[model samples]
Target chain A: MNDKKWIVLGLILFVGLFSFPFWFNVGKAAPAPEVVLTEQAKAAKECVMPTDFMKTEHMQLLDVWRLKVVRDGVSQFVNADGKEFDMSLSNTCLDCHSNKAEFCDRCHNYASVNPYCWDCHIDNPKGDK
Target chain B: MNKFYMSSLLAIFALALIAWVGAPALPWLFGIVLPYLAVAVFVVGFVRRVMGWSRSAVPFAIPTTGGQQRSLPWIKQAKFDNPSSKTGVFVRMALEILTFRSLFRNTRMKMNEGNRLSYHLEIFLWLGALAFHYAFLVTLLRHMRFFLEPVPGAIQMLEAVDGFFRLEILYDSVQFGLPGVYMSGLVLLAAAAYLFLRRLFIANMRYISLPSDYFPLLLIMGIAFTGILMRYFTKVDIAAIKQLAMGLVTFQPSIPAAISPVFYIHLFFVSVLLAYFPFSKLMHLGGIFLSPTRNMLANTREVRHVNPWNYPVKVHTYEAYENEFREKMVEAGLPVDKMPESAPEEMTEEEKE
Candidate 1:
């Protein structure tokens, strides 16, 4: 085999880089981040949309809300169930899901999504202990 | 349509349908089992292919030189193009791999009205190839977020940059704006489409293109389409997807119920790609380095390259030949190395009889 040492070295690098994630998380338990719902959220039993819709498309909804409220000056939103609510993340949505660390950060951190929403809006507007 | 690409396209469609329909029923197979098997085959097969290539001796310095080779001290040499040293070869290989330098020199020929030939520099193939490769690489790197438990900051930063050209567009009647749209996936899809089109639309390319060529392009395009479908059109549960990804890497596999069948289709295409890589022309990933014409030094004039396959052969010496033919030579009045006993000048007892 010509250039045996170099070929072996190259192969090692290739395998090491591709299998990085495996070795990085080997022997480590990666439990799915569980969101803790506040009592208010639990009692309400519903959100602006269904649980499944919110699970996949909460970000898109938030974007639509931001455009409507801040840009269009339309603070009132009408949901599918003909339910009307204020289009404010801090005042309306966060009112029920107040536990930002457990609810928002849990999944956000798990998915590594750095939403710019936190740049302006407070994590917890209610400041309940 | 040629039977080659038609069969290839059909095979891809069949594979996709299998995963899209079968994943829910056999989650363990699509989610856990096939991915592991595919990776194993990919790694082992890739190494074996490389080793197989290395076993065959180069036996010659056949670097494809495009510039002046190293020669006279006064003559200026194209160091990178026609490398004579290891360092030069390294730089050349780097440029070749990184930039597709050779492809950039592509030219198109057309016969004019008067039987005259005209050449035009072709750059689209090189451009398409470059875009396809880089976008694919970036997309692959960004996917690491799923496998890693605590997704690294570097990957997050890469994601931010890749999606820097953010646009707010209404896709499938839903306006998406929060995460924006990553450019790598779109670029990959577009570039793949372009490459595939090149083979289909171009007369010469279409004639020469084989099933092997179309298969990978179609497979990758299918992978991209399913991925885009999951990301934008039919949004899958990211958290559940992440959970499944983490499970695979941690060797504690699970199939989350929330995952969409589209993900399975995408995964199926990816798995097929991995398994097919070493056996297909995709081995160019490894072949580029082992290619004798690209990697060898163009210093055949200076360095003596002995063929390793040369062997010793039995030969009759001139002295043995003269000894056997000496009597015949003396009789024929031809020059002889030694006087024969029957020669007129030297008479022997045996010859006297």
Candidate 2:
């Protein structure tokens, strides 16, 4: 073959690049992150939304809550089951799922997501509020 | 639309539908079996295609020189454009690949009103192409976060840069809590769409365009659309998606329940694209490196290039011709190197050996 060395070099590059994920993760089967729910969360029996909805749509719901609170000044959220709760993350959501590292950061770190919620809202609010 | 584009569009839809419809019942097939198969086909087929190209010998140095070639030392030479040396050729190839130097220089010839000719520089094609390719590359690299355990800092940094202009406010109408929109994905989709429109609206381009040309474009658009939809509109359990991605990479494939069918559709389009890569124009990825016209050194004048396929042929030398025609030359009173066996005494200089 013409330019045998160059062809071989290119093939090596192609194979190496495409097969990267395999060798990079070889023997390193990092399991999916498990978010730890607090005792308060467990006792409550359910979140504002269902577990499935919360798992997938929590970010959007939280965003809406923020918008509603800040923009429209509406603080109360009425869930589908006609139960009213405060539309605040630190007050309502964290009131139950308290440990941000255990509950929020685990999945966020696993998914490599850096949600800016921590930039403003404290992970663990103190006793007063 | 042309039948070719329609067929390609229909094909993508069919594949997406198959994954969406078949995923619940055959998660193993969509999530595991097909992905592996697609990768296998892509790798093996790509190698085979490259090998086939290698086997076909390029008998000449046919680099398309775009500037003054190497000649007299006093004459200015365009070293990179009309490269006569290996290093010059390397620089030329690098510039051609990285910055698309040739496409930047692309001009379309136009017949003037007065029977004259003119050339207009076509820069948008180059811009669109550059945008399309770079965005695609960034998007592909960003996806490494999913496959790699302990996702690399580089990818995370890239994601940050790509999503620097956070449009969280715009996403409120759609389901909330979505990550800021990454520019790479949007740019890729927009660029691909622009290229598609260029093919459709431009008269010359439309005339030259074939089904093969439109298939990849439509397929890519479908992939991008599904990807964007999954990220923002029909949000999937990303953590679950990441888990599946990690599992696939680590050879421990398992599908989490209740994951959106949109994910499956996206995966299916990608799988089809991968499987179709080598067989389509996408092989330009490899073909560009081996292209004789682009990759060769423009040194045909300075250096001799022997044709490898040349074979020995019987030939009559000048000596043999002179010897045969010696007697006739002497009789015709012409100069002769040698005397014939029976010749005139005055004409005879030497006996025939």
* Chain B TM, every candidate: 0.91, 0.88
- Label model 1 with its docking quality class: medium
User: Residue A98 of candidate 2: its Cα lDDT?
Assistant: 86
Over A3-119, each residue of candidate 1 has an lDDT whose tens digit, in order, gives 878998999999999899999997899988999999999999999899999999888888878778777888998998999999989998899999999999999899988888889
TM-score of candidate 1 to 2 decimals = 0.93
Model 1: CA > 4 A from native: B113-116, B170-174, B312-353
How many clashing residue pairs, candidate 2?
A: 3
lDDT of candidate 1 at residue B348, scale 0 to 100? 51
Interface RMSD of each: 1.5, 1.6
User: Taking the tens digit of each residue's C-alpha lDDT, what string does model 2 give over B161-259?
Assistant: 998988765334444226678888989999999999999889889889887898899889988999898887777888899999999999999887778
Highest-DockQ candidate? 1
The window of 10 residues in a row where model 1 chain A has the poorest summed lDDT is: A1-10
lDDT (tens digit, per residue) of candidate 2 on A4-117: 788989899989988999999999978888888888889999999999888877888888888888988999999999999999988898899887888899888888899999
- In Å, residue B335's CA in model 2 sits off its true spot by 13
